[model samples]
Target chain A: MLVGTASVEALAASAPTISAWREQAVELRGVTCLQVTAEMRRAAREAVLPPALHPTIPAAISIQAWRVRDGDLGAFDFVCCRVSCRSGVRARGFTTGACASTERASSGLAGIFGFPTRTATIDFRQGYDGADLRVEVKGKTILALGATSPEPMGPDDVQYTSTLNLAHTPNGLRLVQVEAHHLASKIDRLTAHLDSFDGEAFGDARLRPYHVVSASIASEDISLPGVRFVCRPDELAFTGTEPVSRA
Target chain B: MKFGIFFELSTPRPFSRENEWRVYHNALEQCRLADELGFDHVWAVEHHFLEEYSHSSSPEVFLSAVAAQTRRIRLGHGAVVCVPEMNHPIRVAERAAALDIISGGRLELGTARSSTWTELGGFGVNPDDTKITWEEFVRVLPQMWMSEEFEWRGKSFSMPARNVLPKPLQDPHPPLWVTVTSPGTELDAARRGLGCLGVSAAGYEEQERRTKEYHRVIQQCEPVGGVVNDQVHTMNFLYCHEDYRVARDIGVPMVTAFNVANAHLYWTREAFPTRAYQTLGNAGAAMKAKSRPADDPSAAKGLPEGVGVGDPEHLIATIKRWESIGVTGINFLLNAMEMVPQEQVLESLRLFAREVMPKFRDPGDRSRVYAPTTVPGFVSDPTC
Candidate 1:
């Protein structure tokens, strides 16, 4: 069995604490999500994930930028980068880092959902022809994703896997399972081009995109539910997974 | 219904030379026994880099060995992964032809574009091109087998005109099949007039729906092969015992072992986000949903529906359900991860043959529609 070899301490470095986790579920309407997936350099694949997860073959990464038109935290844009991995048999994404357009959006993401977030300028746009995302931190451009040739597809065509967020919990440092439900109204396949990326800013300097795989944009109602499960970062999920304690 | 044994040649952990040797020898023994018991076919899958789950990477080689041992049983070189990186069209035709000649024209050719990123990425196969490449492979293979000299200028590869040597013993070419793991692939099979070799575990309703759609679509088929192999052969597990509890006691572990091992592979959709791969295509999705801990004794009371497990009666009923859904054949995976001992697997085959198989076998079976029709390179009246 292939397991990740990254140290728990290293993975938790960019993870928020459970102190920010809330039990309330937040639902955002009319969210336009543009996701670009790219295969990462295979040499540093194992170093990007904790031991509880298994790195995908030809290790890959997904960069998702979402534009929220209306939400409890008001309208804001954010971009999240995740390493594709597996927790036991199910597909999961290991979040490396996230950047929100506004401080309010960053705090809401960090305090409510335990996202490892910081305030940054995010330009996320979707039009009839294509979708594009640009992320800038401290007046320096960090990432840019451009997708073209929008081919309409069914809503069920795109699958969003649950995410594993490595965070310091009340109990200990655990990989929290953050599952968001999406009801997509429309979806389009796109030809993706990754113009620039700074892997260092995305929590790991070694996390470089080797090849662009695919891109898609979806109009969806995104819901962030309360945390349900967490697993020990150093052990396999079969033995280490436990239910989240309400207390 | 036609009953066949499928081999993954799943060797246990501590994957030593001795363990691999034991797996091969045991599989040969099982094949010999299956032939003696009047089993119809022996299908071997082609997989790569899938440790413990499937070690039979070179299925043509394995099927040739089985041919040397068995006399009457047909050899199914099931699903040579139809990727340009993994298999060139000419090479696939050459190997299948040789295997067919070795088996005295009893070879059934099955093709597929693999689902796992483990195999595809290992071979450096781009996920987007697999479907197109598979289409090109299937379209060219028959031409290679039938023509004195064949050439192709295609998207995946271009070959100069040359006689693909060692033409198959079967008149035009062997029956063609395509392994259906993804949901819409049955339509691909139907449209191409190839057999639907279902390698995944789908429920009765889903299977019925797919069967209906397949039959509906094949009516307008533009065949990719010499003859339209209008058959639906589902893959399942087989473990029979007089006592249902005992069957569950020994059998559930093997199934669990196989499911876990199958799930271990990184699927295409998980790694490469694309419309090409929508779901994790395998038995892992369907079977894993209802799986309990194999050692959970409390879980061994009733028969799992549609599985070839439990007593002979239960096996009969399960086979009947499949038959009712227009499945022409079933290929059984006898052991996985070598979870069942060699002796026990043999015993299970013997018990199933004696008490369960006879109940379904009929001299006038309608599934004989799948038999070699006198009209070569064409489909007979499928309405029978």
Candidate 2:
């Protein structure tokens, strides 16, 4: 019954464009991901989400930083900001903005998967006791997060929602459903502290992270499969879901 | 096996006082029919801030209204959320006692720690502490009912010595039960010598496993009340019609509507990551993928086993499967989203009572008496 009220044009202003849907899956191995989630203020509950998705109660945001040791685009780090939401009953995240450590990685990701990515200085480190992430744009720190007191848990204990990336495709301007498969060898839950975040640099000024809910670090293999579906940005997913591929 | 009706009191969109009034009155009408048709009990859920999914936040009031309307049908004051913020243990005890007195001792007390962040987070309750808080409430409620002056120095709440007033009409207390939503919670019920009120939609295999574990552990339990309630009451849907297609046509959408509304609630695991909360709870377990194809040969036989839809014959086979696996009783949800017309709902209850219920009980068997003396009762007519 509750639908997001944000204008699709405003949301599409900063979204990356995808020329075509990739038919092949992209694989990255030995990736260390540090994900920090925090509840956002209620004011941004529907202001940041497109109508196709439903904003979660007491809106929340997740900031994830990944260090890819070996991948198709070579060694690089990536940081992305996502607003938590639901895409027709399934939990999904709307990617607000992202930055890649290298130009090659940024261009590759943007072209293949519509990752709203730009090159930035990203330092993501994970040790036994703690994990830390710092994202810098033009020598100005945009986001910094620290997670401590690591408690080991099984990899299956963690759940990852699919990402909805707004992008221009062959069909039209649509929200691409990009699902990823993760096979993790290690996972840890941590107490997190948000040191700083520049919401404007994250593509929206209302994207500020409020109270921290949880943080986790995992060592895993990440696979991004080809896009299978897209939905109209201004309509509900129940009525807007359009399949992009037969498979 | 005992049969009861469960009410979530789901009111669909355009949630107005008018809409809520209609839902309430319609549910009351159904309760009246269930009572007249020899149903054992009527269980009302306690939920808050969950729009459309459940508007029965004040179930004690709702159950009291039912108490005033009907006799013989037991009142299940289910699952007064045993959280300090949502409900103080003292208030829960006092209210249950009052409801028991009002219902003439025909009351079943059900306790639970809520499973939704929509509720726990709304009340500012820390999800990690809910288990311990629920533990304390279950232990102290019986003591409050039995003691003349009760004092508590518990981890979640504390109070000076005070007589929790308005003792229940039952001799010691009402039958104590804990709602089992997440896995392993039935063990908590068993260890506390409480009844297992399963609210989730687990299939026969998983339920049989849980039932086995519950029966085994309850044999050595340290009960939280004067008597241990070993009953296992599983929740189900009811949409009986003589025509099988009619039942499927109407019943599947009601189930889907309830599941979707239930999924809208923000689950505790999604918001707060902790061992205390594991699964998404409720709709997560209930919303299963379509396992059988439409063209499957078994499609003509009517709905699958354990689904309480279809013709009376299908429901009989389904309930027999449940009984085969040791389910003591079942609580049926008659309607959701008001999908079934009021007249049809009343008809479904009447039809099920006439066709399916008799097969389970003897000719002279009547509704179980709630309490020996204080409870004013009803003698069910076999001809009805």
Candidate 3:
């Protein structure tokens, strides 16, 4: 009588699945999944704003990460990210437009520009090339253009832009490789990105630690080369010397 | 005024697929009949992985099926092994609550920390930690019942705040009981404020003394788990026939065989090095020794001391003595190890109900005659 009449299928379907990209791969040593997510959200909110923006933007984010310690090769970590602008405007009369975008990027440069290029699409495109890189903002600039003006201005006329990046880390990227091997199929998209491009528009954008990403390795192969990544989903710590900044 | 039958669905000695199903269906049929016959309760034992002695591993499943069929007879778990290793406390609470709703609150939760080595070792349970785990379970069960979002960080198990659903139909909870086979356990049950289910097959004098001790300890009991105080119930074997000699000839051996089989299964743990004491070799030898035909008449003498195996008149007399000794109710062990035919056991139950039960039907007349005046110093109250 202690066992309920509820079917296993009903229970399985109703339980929540991992949601939120910012929270995808952060790990906590001795904590429940819920606690880990909460901690990740706190850190995302405290993250420094891009230098070009005049004022700090208040934002919220979440992530979901999973690692396979054993069994068939698959995603080591999958994450989703979201951000909302609290304040800032281009002009007094222009209507504010909110845009959302989703992208799948690799944790490794080999994965990012190797065989297949990971694509992130936006609403507008304005080419801005740095010293050796051509960076394109696909959507309307954060600042609104005056309706009466004949030409549009850039950063001088804008407040801030809303952008979200969803990518796999080295550990997470490894998992994708293992999963490709496990499924017995070649990875056409990521492989093409890795083989075709070098330091083109992103000029060793691959060199940027933030730009560098990795996939999760199969849990069974936790000891494989460059695949033994143990990052707490709850704890956010910066590693490399370069600080995070906007282009 | 509750009357019920305990089923292990035991199929000892002559094992047959037909006989096994026969015993099982008979118990289900008995529950239906007991409901029709106006019996107040029908209980089953929960055991795991034991072969012939017990096949009723999942009592909840069996009882749920029983619930579907019976309308009036309350279904009871004589004792649920409340160790975390075997079952989680939350699972136990949730399951019990669901059963109560299914059975219209006719579920009685009788719990205990298991004593046998076979059950303990097979599940990797530590003997010394049994009491602690049981106490923790008892402590947490009530919170699970009362709170919408229950959370606890105990020594053994911990969980975050979450509402545990499908609470029991009974207000507060079902009547909780604990099984006790020894004198110390009887007193312990009283101090914990749980119902004492005395299962030892002891003489009338010993039963009287233990019952008295239970009442004495219960008077000052500050409840440990949920309830404020405890209730007490005793167990006895029952078999009735038209002729005293006929009943003695058939029923005595069956009861004797059950006792020997149980003792051998559990007591042999003292000899083995392994945590699991169940050795098929030892159990088989014990059964063989017990079933051996006596060469001399003196070897197969009078009823094995404590067993109640006789005609209607004798059974009634035995029950009266138990009542006089201050025991609340007697759980009759009707069909044990399939020693007797299903039909014969049913006949015994019917005859006993017709001839013996009516005598003790009055609620006012059944109250304990001697109330204990004070609590003994050795009996410490259980702390939740």
lDDT of 1 by residue, B264-314 (tens): 677876655566787786745465336445653334466555677788877
Looking at model 3 chain B, report the run of 10 residues with the lowest lDDT sum.
B267-276
- Which order, best to worst by lDDT? 2, 1, 3
When superposed on Cα atoms, how far off is each prediction in RMSD? Answer: 5.2, 6.1, 25.4
Considering every candidate listed, which one attains the maximal TM-score? 2
Write the residue-wise lDDT of candidate 2 on A1-247 in tens digits. Answer: 6678888888777777787777888898899988888888878888888998888766788888889999888889999998888887777888888999999899888877788999999988787789888899999999999999988877766667789988888768899898989889988888999999998888789887878878888899999998898999998887899999533
Q: Say which prediction, candidate 1 or candidate 3, comes out ahead on DockQ.
A: 1
Q: Taking the tens digit of each residue's C-alpha lDDT, what string does model 3 give over B1-384?
A: 345677777776466888777878888987887777666667788876555667777788889989999886777875788888998888898999999999987888888776554576557676547777777877677667766778888876888877777788875667777777644677777776777776555566667788899889888775644444355666667777878777778887777556544643322122112222222222332233233234422134444333457766666666776778887677777867777787888888888777777776864432222121222232222222
Number of the top-ranking candidate, with lDDT as the measure: 2
Residue-level lDDT tens digits of model 3 in A105-187: 22221232121222223222111210011112354122111111112222111111122121233322111111011220111
lDDT of 2 by residue, B125-153 (tens): 98879999999888888788888777888
Docking class of 2: acceptable
Candidate 1: how large is its RMSD? 5.2
Return the top candidate by DockQ: 2
Ranking by TM-score: 2, 1, 3
Question: How would the docking of model 3 be graded?
Answer: incorrect
